[model samples]
Target: MQGTLKDAREVAVKKLSRGLSQGAKVFMNKAMLLSCVQHKNVVNLHGYCTASICQKGGQRMLWTP
Candidate 1:
């Protein structure tokens, strides 16, 4: 998905596939990879995050903010 931040900077956002996602641990890995690559003409990566919710009875809820 694409969006514009409050600063008016355009960005492209990739939604992690819930079926294949691995929460924050993996998210940080991907972000690290993105941060390591550099190119004069390529866009720079900002960061990433993982959000989740746990309910009573040990139910797990996953979501993105």
Candidate 2:
């Protein structure tokens, strides 16, 4: 999924391609990136969710502020 930030809020939603590698790397990468940035130009990262496999048959991650 694709989204744009508004009013100091940021959101990122990832729709994983099927048969992709299952590893902690994806989450780790997002966590690392979110930890480093804190600025007005950068909308704050609020939270995230890992989608159920039955829905899309692949993980979907969503982050918001």
Candidate 3:
């Protein structure tokens, strides 16, 4: 999805599927790369989040974002 920051800069937000091991691995790899790795074509990653909300059943996600 698209979003606008406080500075009025437009940006993209990506939330990958929750059920795949490959997706989780990709998320970790992206998170590991700091903004210092600069390139004209590569966009900088702003942030990410992972949450596990409890439920009566075993609905908790053991890992991944």
Candidate 4:
């Protein structure tokens, strides 16, 4: 899912698979990879979200733009 602020900034939402291991390593990896990435065409990571949604399934997701 995506949403925009009154200022017209674009936002993205990612939904991770359910039953993913509960640990910090996964998040660390994602952050590390994003930091090392350097290219003109590479996607930019905005942030990540981990919480139970009203919809069924999943607790982790990565959002990028």
Alpha-carbon RMSD to native, per candidate: 6.9, 5.4, 7.3, 3.8
Q: Which of 3 and 4 is the better model by lDDT?
A: 4
Q: Pick the winner on TM-score between candidates 1 and 2.
A: 1
> Stretches of candidate 1 above 4 Å error?
40-42, 51-65
Q: Write the per-residue lDDT of candidate 4 for residues 1-65, one digit (tens) a residue.
A: 78654467777765555545535468658756875787889777766655456223645656566
Q: Using TM-score as the measure, which candidate wins?
A: 1
How much does candidate 3 score in TM-score? 0.50
- lDDT score, candidate 2, position 21: 62
TM-score of each: 0.56, 0.44, 0.50, 0.52
Q: Best candidate per lDDT, number? A: 4
Sort the candidates on TM-score, descending order: 1, 4, 3, 2
- In terms of lDDT, model 1 sits at 0.53
lDDT (Cα, tens digit) per residue for candidate 1, span 1-65? 67566677666766555444644566668667777768877566764445343222322222212
In model 4, the Cα lDDT at residue 51 comes to 44
Report model 2's TM-score to 2 decimal places: 0.44
Q: In model 2, where do residues sit more than 4 Å from their true spots?
A: 1-23, 51-56
Q: Which stretches of candidate 4 lie over 4 Å from their true place?
A: 5-8, 20-24, 51-57
Instruction: Order candidates by lDDT, high to low.
Output: 4, 2, 1, 3
